[model samples]
Target: MGAVMGTALGAVRVVGGRLGLPVDDLAVLKDGSNLLVHLRPAAVVARVGAVTASVRGDVFGHFARADELSRFLAGRGVPVVAPVAAPVREGGWVVALAEHVPHQAERTLDSTTFAALLRELHQELAHFTGDLPARGPLDDIDAVLALLSRPADLVAERDAVAAGWPELPVQALHGDAHPHNVLFTAGGPVWNDFEDAWRGPVGWDVACAADSRLLDRAAVQRAYPAELLDHWIGVRRLLVRCWVAATDRYRAAPPSPSPSP
Candidate 1:
């Protein structure tokens, strides 16, 4: 197993012990930068990751934030995956738990349904009235630049493009508003994964859904400012490029050595 997956399993083992659940019964569901595992004989799901930006680095802030947001949304009757147990943070790893929703991953979602859910989400988020990180895609430009081994010309070009965007009305938005982030269930669409949640232009979310090409762009334009939409579209393209580059670097990195017995 890779280091991350091993760490995830170890964290799950710790959490499972505390909950009196069998670690052997746990099954891996999804594995990536984050690990999703199903806690069998229980309705909870464990999301293991090192997403925190903290002093001790014992907690994953993004996952922590998601748990908080889930509770907030659930209180207001917004459909979302619910958290069942307190998160476990130990040994420089975090195992956050949440209630799992049964659903199928549809190849495509109805444009009208998707837009309606987004509108509902926007409405609820507007009243969140809580502190959150401001969403500016370029806010991570410095990190992206470093990750891609910054070229002077590319840095200048990216900065220039970023400078041209005019600020628009800002509110708490689902930072990564792509279709995959949304879960369609028998009840309705449940918005999960609030790790990227931030205060940003509403247009950013609209632009994101549109970029997926699964929504009616014309309908989105009618609901949001065209200028903001265009600006975010440009920003999304840059974000995707940086993501691709970073993933390539990560995949090319040397694997950790196994411990000697």
Candidate 2:
């Protein structure tokens, strides 16, 4: 196993054991930007920011905010994956324990249903009054550019994109509203991963969910102007590229001191 994955697994096992949850059957459910571990024989899943820790300045704070938002959504009858407990700082990793709902990872919802569900989520999110970064993912660009030593071409593109950022009505958003973040459970499609939650233009969320084959672009355009959607879509694309570059550079660098919790 890779060092990051091994460390994440060990941390979850330690945290799970401390909480009196079973660890004998602990298994990794997913390992991507972050690690999702199922603390089995129990319904708890641990979200370990293995890779995210490298880029985010406050990994614990990030997960804590997500946990808070999930609870809020759950209390309001939103179909969101709520946390089982608060985020725990252990072994230099931030671990969030949440209810592990069984889901069909390969299931795909039709465009109409998908768009409608996303709209429902947005409706609820509008009521959230929590503190969130105003610019959303756009706020991460400077830090990521710094990590990549300010690539000339990317810096120019970022500047151009920043100049076009719209001034529109803002609300809490599922910052990363892609189809993959939706879990198709028997109960229904439950949204997961609020780590990127932010207060920004609703268009930002719309653009995030506008996967060509998964959501009808016309449906999205009806709610927000097509021009605005197109702008946010371009911005989202740029942010994605910046994050990819940052993750690569962060991973390639030598280990650094873990941030204080």
Candidate 3:
């Protein structure tokens, strides 16, 4: 839970037990259902990071992939810790109960910090491989454009990017790199939520994710070099503006009159 919905310790214990949480010592985070149980006996907390039955859910196959990636990172001695085990949920949904890190890498990130994490996540994305669900930019671009009330140039830009994107160096990207998905801990920035990860160019995450935030594009441009940052900023604005217009279309569209039978 959080400041919004304060959680109860007793309620936590019950959920913990249901998930075979240790009946002994650790403290529950109360928030981040990802770490659902605290193993008092072992001084560890188990994060309910994945649900097998969540095929149509947010973190469906993510449980398995999260574990694999976590392990992969740890083996490389990257600042992240591998949650205890990346096991599949026992029944129905493939729920995963992984180790909960004492602290995440980053939170409430400024431009510098967020950018650094973006670079780190990009590195992790480069290492990922194996059979995983996929979603293409063509589909995403079309869906986003169809719902928007923007100029056709917006859709045309997306189309152009899609066609030319294949020529770029593709890596596994953290499909959605918005603020909430990144965690701040003592280490640095721990990226989470692999639900939308896909083999794509850094621009998919870099150009796309950066623009989604309310960061000042001009300031970012000033901070980074001229040429490199300029291209990214342009792409970022295009992506974020289109998304904004898309979300706005339905909200701003006029309501239709009721049919008179």
Candidate 4:
């Protein structure tokens, strides 16, 4: 296992022990921007920030907001994975425990269904009155660019994209509303991972949903204004590239020196 995942596993194990949950069979469900470990036999999962903490300065706050939003959405009858407990800061890692919902492994939703579900999510998200950043993931482009030492061409592209950001109607959004984030459960689609939730144009979420090849672009486009969706799609592409570069840089950097005891 990687150092990051190992650290995350250790942290989650410690938290699980405190909560009286079993951890003997702790299995990693996913390991990407964050590390997700299934606290087996307990119907709980731990979302541990890995590379995400390196990029997002307020990782703990993000996890807390996600937990809060998940609870609110669940209460409103939205199909969302509810947090099982409050977020815990342990072993220099932020871990959020959530109900381990079983989902279909191979099933996929059609474009129309996916679009409809996203619309439903947006309709409910509009009612969220919680504080969120006005800018969405695009705002992180600046930080990623800085991590990459601000390449001249990429900097120009970033500035151009920022210049074109439209002043559109804004509401609480599922900031990372992509296909992988939605699970096809026996109970239907359950949305997961709201750490990137922010208050921004609905187009940002629409752009995210449409970017996936698993969905029909035409069907997704029919649900939103083509012009707005197209603009944000381009912006999302840039953000994706920046994040990839940032992740690579982060992985290549040497560990920080230990401070004097």
Candidate 5:
């Protein structure tokens, strides 16, 4: 394992052990903004290092708060992946244990199902009365753009969005609801990753789904004006690109400081 993964895994093991959850068979499911690991012999999957102190401001509450959103949605009959246990935050790293959902990682979501799911998600999100950090993509653009070697072009695009923000309608959103964020499980389609849950132009979420090319653009436009959808599409596309670029750069940089004792 590389330095960052090695440190993150070690922290997860320590945190899981303390929480009395299984950690012996920890296997990485993914490593990006956070390290997702499956603890064998236990139905729990742990998410570690997904939230940092600096980024926590941009996040809803903290890592554990995801359960709040999950329960809120699940209680309302939204098919979000369930959280199996409360989160553990220690040593500057937060780990959330949740159900280890089985899914076809290679499956392609049908256009009709994708549309229905998004519509349902937005409807449910509108009713969430719980507390979450009020945020929008514009809130983190500077941090993301800083990671790029040549950010002039992206900077120009960002400024334009800022100038036009006054006229757009705002609502609760699945901040990063790209196609890959939806998992097709035996239980049916379930939305994963609520770290980006925020209040913003609902069009931002629709644009992200559209960019995934899994949903029909015309169908998406039905929920948003064609011009507005097109505008947010460009905004979402650049945001995603910058996010990927930031992740790649962070992973390639020198190892981060070890977790505090």
Candidate 6:
């Protein structure tokens, strides 16, 4: 698929001459999910390329919807990926671009640096929730319903807890906040994957971050804000457990929502 798209793009470049932008293939990185590429004009102004590409991402939302998020994050002063030139208009398939955030690797999420970044992210998220459509854990429940196991009571639980919790914030959110989704740069940590930005509780996102076994638990607890940590761990057993049932790693047995004969 990568080769096919590259070839077609090359063909277009040949026909359009200078107008046909050359797409530079950025070879596979540590994570094998994206097909990295660079887009540039015919003019020679070497060093920095204006835009970078990641073919697809699980967190990406519809273009217009995503635009709202990208802009919102910028307004809130969060370090999320910056949207590049408007998405190239293509029917059926879509390609989105963002300014390449150059950064060093910090795979370990337990460092004080990481903890500080998380604090910043939560702060920004708190601000982010004030501007968008307010949603609750209930929204996530619907999507993962078919994929979960022993999730029969999840819906009821989400409703009650959400009622007890404060209203969902409307500000721009990373939607899927996870360690890997965050990248470090000279400016600080930048969150990637804006597809899931929506008006939902930090409840689920924070839970996923703190509960990730891949991360150093002590470091997270030591560093995260008291309120943030409280909410994250607060819903871990119920929401996060339900999320696990929805994930591919689990053999989901989401109760059949069927009518009895």
Error of 2 at 202 (Å): 0.6
RMSD of each: 4.0, 2.0, 9.1, 2.4, 2.8, 9.2
Q: Give the candidates in order of TM-score, highest first.
A: 4, 2, 5, 1, 6, 3
Q: Any idea what lDDT model 6 has?
A: 0.49
Report the lDDT tens digits of candidate 3 across residue range 1-261.
342122233333444567666754646554333435566765445444311111123344556666666666667655544565454433222334455655533346776556566776666657767654444344445556654443588867876655544455567766666666666777665655554566655655655445645454443333332334345445556655654554454334422211212
**Candidates' lDDT values, in order?**
0.70, 0.81, 0.51, 0.83, 0.71, 0.49
Q: Please say which candidate is ahead in TM-score: 3 or 6.
A: 6
Off by over 4 Å in 5: 50-65, 146-150, 222-227, 254-261
TM-score of 4: 0.93
Q: Which candidate is the best by TM-score?
A: 4
Ordering by lDDT: 4, 2, 5, 1, 3, 6
TM-score of each: 0.84, 0.92, 0.54, 0.93, 0.87, 0.56
Clashes of each: 0, 0, 26, 0, 0, 12
Q: Which segments of model 6 are wrong by more than 4 Å?
A: 1-20, 24-66, 75-77, 105-112, 125-133, 136-141, 144-172, 225-261
Displacement of residue 169 (Cα, Å) in model 6 is 6.9
Per residue, candidate 2 scores C-alpha lDDT tens digits across 1-261 of 767667678888888889899988888887767889888779899998855777777777779889989999999999899898899888778889999999998896765577677788988988999888877676777768877789999999899988877777788989898788899999989999999999988778778877445777776566544348888888888888988887677567634436435
Can you write out model 4's per-residue Cα lDDT over 70-148, one digit (the tens) per residue? 9999999998998988887887888889999899867778877888888899899999999998777766888777767
Candidate 5: RMSD to truth: 2.8
Kindly list the per-residue Cα lDDT of model 1 for residues 1-261, writing each as its tens digit.
677567658778888778886677788888654678888867778886632221112235556667777789889998888887766565556778888788878645766567667878988989887777774466555565765579686688688776786667788888788888888788767888887677878878888887776777776666543456777887887877765555555556623322212
Clashing residue pairs found in predicted model 4: none
Q: Which tens-of-lDDT digit does each residue in 51-76 have in candidate 6?
A: 11121122223444555666666887
